[model samples]
Target: MQTYPVDIDPEQLIRWLEAKHAASPSVFRITAVRATDERMVPPRGTHLDDLDREDLREIATIATLEIAPAHASEGWLLTVVVEDEVGPRLPDKGALIEDEQTIDLVTFDQEFIRTGRGNASVVAAVEGPEAEKRMARLLHSIEADRHNSGPAKSTD
Candidate 1:
């Protein structure tokens, strides 16, 4: 198996997450923005100065905006999942299908959304929407796989 590492800003991730949540406000919720890096994403640019709570909220909002009704209705969240590592509830078990080994963003339902670790991306990318769709498919696949996997194994 081949794998690669992806780097993303926490605040940006939060924004993206919240954006998706905005679509289906009734289903999803913005619980927390957990990350080891307290700084999150450094705000910059021709007009920007520094990262602030607004930046974080925007990041979360953008992420949430990317959420499609098909996925959001099922409680999908944008997250980063590394292989074989136990983390937060991300919805997917690291099953991602993409042309690139390392992608800036990926969607995990509940099995991979973790915090106090580097996973979500806070920086904006040119192909943000494309990335969102790709991740959405991955999340949909996770749900499908779970349905196919059938009953859980019992410890006896």
Candidate 2:
């Protein structure tokens, strides 16, 4: 296991995970970031993108990201929303994440996630094989979209 200092760029974190993925296949779990309802609520677009500051504020917090590599160029992004509601469920039903371990969130810098405050804005990649099935094993998604290098996705 490797150790990272407190507060690092989200991209750097992802890059580090990518490197780790290169070394060996492991699910890259990340901290949830604040987000706007635009993307969090469906119909959600396919593919992950960077989140803006203002946008990050509107969304929920406290969600853990479970990124499992499905392909060399692509992977599965599951936003593991805890059973704790307060978040608008995808179907508003029948889905929630369980028993997935996420790394330390201090590095991500999202206060809500780091401190376990609010709900969460999820962004999971519903592409590739076994995507739905994998999510079936685990539920409610596993990622927050606080991309790019900087402070927490949403800090106020």
Candidate 1 weakest ten by summed lDDT: 57-66
lDDT by residue (tens digit), candidate 2, 38-147: 22433245243443222321223233555544432433454434222344333324433333334444433344444445543444564555554553333311133222
Instruction: Give the Å error, residue 85, model 1.
Output: 17
Candidate 1 on 44-116: residue-level lDDT in tens? 4424444343343112111111222333333224333222323222233453323222212233323234333
> What lDDT would each prediction earn against the true structure?
0.33, 0.38
> Could you tell me the TM-score of candidate 2?
0.28
Residue 76, model 2, lDDT: 45
> TM-score winner among the candidates?
2
Best by lDDT: 2
In model 2, which runs have C-alpha deviations exceeding 4 angstroms? 1-25, 29-66, 70-75, 80-104, 140-156
